[model samples]
Target: MTEAVEYDVVVLGAGPAGENIVDRTRAAGLSTAVVESELVGGECSYWACIPSKALLRPALARADARRVPGLAEAVAGPLDAEAVFAHRDYWTGHWKDDGQLDWLESIGAHLHRGHGRLHGVRTVAVTGPEGEHELLTARHAVVIATGSRAVIPDLPGIHGARPWTSREATSARHVPPRLLIVGGSVVAAEMATAWQALGSQVTVLVRGPRLLPRMEPFAGELVAEALREAGAVVRTEVTVEAVVRDGSTGPVTVVLEGGEPVEGDELLMATGRSPRTEDIGLDTVGLTPGGWLDVDDSLRVVGHDWLYAVGDVNHRALLTHQGKYQARIAGAAVAARAAGGSAGAGGVDTGRWGAHAATADTAALPQVVFTDPEATAVGLTLAQAERAGLRVRAVDHDLGKVSGAGLYADGYRGRARMVVDEDRQVLVGATFVGPGAAELLHAATVAVAGEVPVPRLWHAVPAFPTMSEIWLRLLETYRG
Candidate 1:
């Protein structure tokens, strides 16, 4: 017979989303148990965000120094790749989760080590490495936070070749001498920046005409320019037809459609991501497995009050920070119901910006791509606003012409856009692209989320001689 454990909440997949949900549920005096098959800290901690940023920091620092006339000479030497790898290992805790596990225990949440599958509504089955079987039943809600896996295209010979995903690219101990990356989104642009800086001849192939297709077109143009300047090659309008590897120690040769075959020591597929919901037993709950789960604004699964899907699994926003945001909403929503109140009165006041509502997911979502010329945007793009039939005007400003930008970098190149809901006289969205532009995103996030009126925003003065002053320039552009 399988041992059975009961908790007020049982969370599957202890990623940032899962951790945040548990954090809120525990704070609400609910007993929560989290199960995981991989490291407790999940992909962002071990592979995606932490490790990738750790590797990119040195390169960005060097690039910044090279911009300064006096410092450029000192930074001309190549980075010590060995030392960089050691630093990344430190950031990722050497792929260990002792610290994270300790923190989870400190939070008074039970940790289960194994694969978790949904047995039924509010029921989960677990199997450990040693062949132990256990059943977990949740009194309140069962959350699917299993996150996503990188999608490797069905190219000929890809399975046998075993190309590197974002995991291997970020966690790699040694930078391959020749690296080719496929895809055109954040992963492609970021990996291209990282490996090329760390002494790899990085080449990127984008089936689209540019990088960062989701953001403003100029953002991709600028990053492609910077990547080339940094000694990386960017190829657009290309597709990988096949990847072949002969032996365990052999290199992978990638053949392209209508293009010459390119050989590389390693091939990194930043193609995309797929929800890891296939084996989670969604089919048992009358939902499709191996597909992105659907959820309501409150994050509860449609037609299943006791089920919730957060993070990349929901296909809402495939970003770590966004996943955490959704987790907070889900946790509060769960806690409210567990506290003997309806989801509406319990704490999920679903009004705009209500305590339990995830309003930003629709109107004020913010993203910052950590590239040399960072692309930051909050709320809608101009095209999106127009598509929504909002009577809006887009104001553009040149950061290169701003006093603060010139003082910060000898030759700074950046662009800013603010989309105004002309009928409402409020900002609906904003985008900033440049060096250290991410630092300016929060102010825009506030403006967009707050829906601050254009007239009132004029009084919110920006301190002069700082990157933030660009906010003033944008407002002025709109006024003019």
Candidate 2:
């Protein structure tokens, strides 16, 4: 027998995005039901962000310590891999979802542990692990926040070779002696830094010319340099032809173009990500399965009044933080429509940069790569601003020249770039590459998002003798 459930809102996938939407909708007095096929907190909590950061933190800390004069002598030793693994396990709660489940219960949202699929308009069919069935009907809105999964390239013998994705790399119990990684994205760079420092000889093969290809070119150069200095092999402009693994417990050999082979205990394919919409019954709703969802600023799916797509599934921004931001806007819009008002009514503000609009997805998206020489950027790159047809000026500064940067490390090597819209006299983009660069991103984000004028930025002074003084240097360079 199939059970019938009713809710004001039905959300698929209890990831960070889904959980936030549930929180927002429930607070608006809307009854919300969340369906999850795996662990409650999803990828960021258990596998991607948390575990990966935990594995990288010790390595980063050690590198930072080595840069300090007195600390350098005292901390010249390898990290305790066992202890690091234990710490990572602790952070991920040993892959348990009890805490997340408790939070959902406290929020008064029903949790359906099953695979949920769209049956019809505003309708979802959930199948529990034991074959129990429940039909969930939403009176207001149905949101798809299922997020994305890693993409492994199709190569001969790849399946039998047992390649690791982002999930396996982050959650591995033991580090391999030789790690082979494919792709030049964040996952590849970060994992290479992590395993190499954690006692693995890492070899990275990038099809592109550089790593972190989406960001400014200097960012990739700096990261690649650091990886090589740390004894990792960074190979770019290479093509992987095939993979070969003889048995269950054997070294995997990656065959490259021109008859070259690279062998390692494990191979990780951090190529890219795809939306997890293939099996969610999108065909029933007149939409294509296995395709990215398209949504407007208010996150409402095109041509569907009762459907919404937030997070990575919407193809707006792939970062977890960006997904959460979109979730907040979508939740507000969903609640507004449920109350018999337009998304813009009742101070919802659906216009650009409004409470109901995910404007940051385009205007001021911020990203931080947690590499040894952390790279962080906001808004647009100089190239991006130029491509957008904006008249811009790029100001550059050497972070090592800053007094505070010199004090932070014996020899701080970094650079900062700010792209200014000449016509508007406001900052349109900023990028920082150096140790502790991630900490200096928010001010740049604010300047770009708020569109603060250059002259006014001079009045909004940075404290003397800090990495933040890079802003002052950049402004000085721009003035001259």
Per-candidate Cα RMSD to the true structure, in Å, reads 1.3, 1.0
Query: Residue 179 of model 2: what lDDT?
Result: 99
Would you give me the overall lDDT of model 1? 0.90
* Residue-by-residue lDDT tens digits, candidate 2, 1-480: 376788999999999999999999999999999999999999999989999999999999999999998889888998899999999999999999999999999989999999999999999999999989999999999999999999988899999998999999999988899999999999999999999999999999999999999898999999999999999999999999999996999999999999799999999999999999999989999999999999999998998989999999989899999999999999998888888876435666778888889999999999999998999999999999999999999999999899988988888999999999999999989999999999999999999899999999998778888899998899899999
For model 2, name the residue pairs that clash: none
TM-scores for all candidates?
0.97, 0.98
213-328: candidate 1 lDDT, tens digit per residue: 98878889999999998888899998788888869879888899975788888999988999999998898999999999989887888999899998999998888999999999
Q: Candidate 2: where are CA atoms >4 Å away?
A: 1-3, 343-348
Relative to the true structure, candidate 1 reaches a TM of 0.97
Q: How close is candidate 2 to the true structure, as a TM-score?
A: 0.98
- Residue 109's lDDT in candidate 1: 99
